[model samples]
Target: MSPVEPFSDDSPLGASGAEGVRALRVAVTRPLSGERLENLLRDAGHAPVHFPLTRIEAPSDPRPLARGARALLRGEMDVLLLTSVRAVRSLAQALETVAEGPWRRPEGLQVWVIGDATGAAAARMGLVPDRIPEHFVAEQLLEEASSWARLDGLRILFPRAAAGRSLLPETLARAGATVTLVEAYRSVDDGEEADRLVRAMGRGELDLVTLTAGSQARVLARAMRGTRPALRCAVPMVAIGPATRMAMVAAGLPEPTVAAPHTVEGVVAAVKTVAGGLQ
Candidate 1:
């Protein structure tokens, strides 16, 4: 699915146009070779290196997630918060297992997604989001969600990975919302792929690395443990959002060029801008 939104303007550095990207060897962090994220890079005229840092796995126990799906279908939850496209898919899987017939939007369930990609995924499952923020960041979501609806005393069902940033749920809890988190999936670091990334970096074959999450930065750092710190600091990188930028820094990697609009298209623009500077 081409969840990537098209940017109307020229690349800020003037790289993407009729001629395509500037032949930059950009390293896309996830979504594999055939996904739209990689295709977006290829269609832009950039050579995108596949770097799968994390793989989504079914949780050790799937019962909780299944129960969450039932709750969603029954309209027992007042609000639904979806942050990633994977979460949407996992929830949908659960729904398919318990659903007796065609998927229908549960009445009275106000769906809220973090980004256009997540929202699109939700819609594909017949779940329409009631609110979406202009910015995709979780912090921004918390800040902007105030204008949407009464968050206090609401039962928010959030089906997410086993481990993730706790800011959203924690803040919602503080806001007096009883948030029930169901581990719909597990985001595990791929050790083999991380090793390959390290070798590529040592060989100086990578022009730049693109990171989509703080978790990716942590995984990259772990994989590059024995390498000289200079190697990591030297390689150009771009973070998909501010939270990721901070995670990169905390993990001892260089601060990356934070992508604006926090989308694949924005990452491409950042790569073009970085490539222009490199030239």
Candidate 2:
């Protein structure tokens, strides 16, 4: 058998069948994830261990975020595109920083989010989530947005992380929308968190590791640097999407199981895919 096995396009739960499988200890690497992903894994009979390897911080310059918020306040922007829950909260903080409380959005502005978590964050902020794509990737969000509204001459405000992919904004620009891409927050590596993860792998405790973003994969690979190559590749890894999978490979790690739909639910299902494969 190959040292690092890969999964096929089989149904996620196909191997479980009528019999039960052993629960896996899945290391979830998202920062401040809390119980959302954990509870989902437990409900599926898997033990999720918190191994946060990345943390979010405010960008060095708040001017761009402030400008984006001010544009929305002044009704200068026609659309708001949020890619992550962190982006939604960061942008909202920028709004409260610029104006008084209870500042409502311009009625003409349409709000669209990428993930269920992003939409939920918007709803928690008392903002209506006008649209959310069925899939949680930027491409899906762009497709869904284009399907509903005319992108021509639209002034769209995209509040996201400092190192986010440019595909969404670039594609929107090509589609004739003027996109204001703001770096609302930045994801930084947590040295202590990385140390803990490396320790766990050394102890051989983790059955699988989950990667949500490219940063997480890169951090993990960097953290595990100098360790035995086989030790790092011993456990299977699952990524939330193609970008993350590519990150895993580029980080000198084996290719990861890419989640379909790229949602948190899809991540849960990916873990199940690994579980079913083990059985």
> Which candidate achieves the best TM-score against the true structure?
1
The residue-by-residue lDDT of candidate 1 on 208-239, one tens digit each, is 89999877889998898888878887779999
TM-score of 2: 0.86
Number of clashes recorded per candidate: 1, 0
Tell me which residue pairs clash in candidate 1. 21-44
Off by over 4 Å in 2: 1-19
TM-scores for every predicted model: 0.91, 0.86
Error of 1 at 205 (Å): 0.9
lDDT of 2 by residue, 1-279 (tens): 001112233423223322365567778888875558877876776667787788888898999999989999999998898878888889889899898777887888888888788889998886778998887777778777778789999999999889988899999999999999999899998867877877777777778889899999888888888898887778998999988888889999887888886877888888878887877
Q: What's model 1's lDDT at 44? A: 69
Runs with alpha carbons beyond 4 Å of true place in candidate 1: 1-21
Alpha-carbon RMSD, each predicted model: 5.4, 6.4
